[model samples]
Target: MPATATRADRSPRAAEPSPRGGRMGALWRVLEGPRALDVAALLIGVCTAVLTVLGLVMVLSSSSVEAIGSTDGSYGLFRRQAMWAVGGLAALLVLRRLPLRVLKGLAWPAFGLAFLLLSLVAFTSLGHSVGGNTNWLRIGGFTMQPSEAAKLAMALWAAAVLERKGRLIRHVHHALVPVLPFGLVLVVLVLLGRDLGTAIILTGILATILFIAGTNRKVFIAFAALAATVATAMVLLAKNRLVRVQAWLFGCEGLETSGDPCFQPDHGIYALASGGWWGVGLGQSRQKWSYIPEAENDFIFTILGEELGLVGSLAVLAAFLGLAVGMYALAARTTSPFIRLTTWGIMAWLVGQAFVNIAMVTGLLPVIGVPLPFISYGGSALTLALAGVGVVLAFARHEREALRREGAPDAPTPDPSVRPQETR
Candidate 1:
């Protein structure tokens, strides 16, 4: 017929592989799209959904005992957790629809609000102390952790500030002036609560944003050293925290003794070890029966290991890893510098905090009382973390649309038999 039809004249779809090799291959074709942004957004959605479901199941299982003893029944805690999950999901949906211009416009007020709330927690009668950290504020019958909100606010604020500073970022003073003042202020307030874990996470976010903004190596180093010195000084000034550091270093040997400060770590290890490879079976963890402290909060990893074994533990790790990879890919592919900087800052914050939580649980690092992100049971932390994930998703969507406008390859097309409109 067209006996000499050239390759260039052939339809581009003719030579493409069919999505029929295997289940995994099909999934691969779908996820490995023409543009990385679409794939990343897809991955973030899938991971967030799976993690949220897993978190709810685990929270119900782990909190049943405490809920029954203190409240109406086992479902008491589960109900509250479910409500928080619903609220968080709603927040995510709403955040996804907001335009980037609106987000940028709100950055300053968000930062100021974050600061005011943090100040109230740190310095006013509104502060509520729990488990040795005065980081919560009780306002008008509602209890909220201001630091969690501050983390998201600061990320937005820093991106806007640094993106505007653009070329001026090469100068040390311009790089440090506004961000350092505002960032260090929020961090200092976090430290005022003696919540060192949250403080470290906030500082990590700040450092990551600075690095992404292209601050000079020498200036960054000096800033890092100053931060480290301040952190060390704060730790040394607090007796309980120094004791925790000491226990982390040399107290494992005395774990079997009653009243030892290492009891928590020792129990955490036992819980993990008890699960072997297949786990003790979901909801059957012995450690949840008053063995591991805060089993539904900071130390939830221990219960996760005990109930779901190494496989479940690794699944959580993998989900976080997927999120990190997806966010980083978006950061690299986006044309907008603010999007790039903000995505990287968020990727660092969530992924770094996740590993920090895991490390503390596995005894690879000192216990820092940091939650395991999407898998933890706390209300404020879960809600804010979900909101951050939503922001990243929004950015990914923007990039995908922008790429399409530039005539970049579209996402995978569907079969006309199944989705006729997608055939074009």
Candidate 2:
């Protein structure tokens, strides 16, 4: 045997792995391990899990009073919620393992498919309308919300478009010609389904993506103004929407026991008031005794307020804020503009919609009939929103891996000198 080999074999550290080999193993482990974005992704996963589980408990408590008298047993809403949870988890796991580039490749095709579905929802023969909105489709016994799919599809398309256009994206003509037209088509289609809320959410996601992608401020302002105008007009045109406007503007309708305009909102406020600081001691909401309607869906947060108290409501908001912060942190870390833009889009959609929903419940904004993201019930909406988050998480994951491969420090920062250099 070679002298060095023989010496090592007989050395005091004979059983120990070689320092070089150990280092290689350690490097390999770090290389193989999940990225920071993945870690950030996990924080979001935890937030959603906490929200979903709490939502289920709240759903059961809030819905059972109505469920027992219905066709299904007391477990009806609970069972459906449980199934949605399982399905959403499966989607998160499966999509997390998918390559970000693969989603990039499929962006346009996915958008096309989603657009087709959006168009199909208006045919009347294929779509299902409930509560005055034709936003769902009957798939066997289950219904799929096409608008939810539209939100994801629009995000992908916006990312892909920005990636392709790159630096040229700042031009007014360029931003309007294609991007504005595409979103208009989506907005029109969504409105055709009489679902202005989802359309507004989709527009919010797209606008945030564009802003992050470095579009001109003038263009963004103009686009925002246009969207606001259309949304305002749409609200005025719809009957119930006008009711919401009245409630928001004048606070005309107050609480009533039953059969009145402010029935639901009144009950919600009453429930929140009844909860006091702590709550009415969970699972014992008086307003949920058929006093509050749709407690499992739109007004679910009221149940949280009534049962979990202000502290619990604040905690829920904190979890959501943490999710927004984590996503923003991941986006701030990524150098790849596409990943950053995508994260911004997802954050705007999730956080913006959450704000709108919570605002509705607190009477800070009009009742928009928007779900509270992961905290609200409904299968199609929950799973689709989560799956979109999974895709953005993949982008964040790849960016972290890219940084690690560069052998750089964990914390990344902008170089002040680079900006002037780039402008020059």
Which candidate leads in lDDT? 1
* TM-scores of all predicted structures: 0.87, 0.84
After superposition, which runs of candidate 1 have C-alpha atoms over 4 Å from their true positions?
1-33, 252-259, 408-424
The TM-score measured for candidate 1 stands at 0.87
Q: For model 2, state the Cα shift of residue 226 in Å.
A: 1.6
lDDT of 1 by residue, 248-335 (tens): 8887564443356687888999999998888999989998887787688878888989989999988998898888877876776566
Candidate 2 wrongly placed segments (more than 4 Å): 1-39, 253-259, 408-424
Candidate 2's clash total is: 0
lDDT of 2 by residue, 1-424 (tens): 2222232233232243334457646643332333435556677777877877887788788888888867788889788888887888788777777787787887889789888988888875778898789988886786788888788788788888888888888888877767778877887888898888888888888888888888889998889899989988998897678776776676655622233557788788888888878998888888887877778888889999988899989989988887886687577656666677777887888889999899888888777788988878788888877787787667766765665555456645445455334553
Per-candidate local distance difference test: 0.82, 0.77
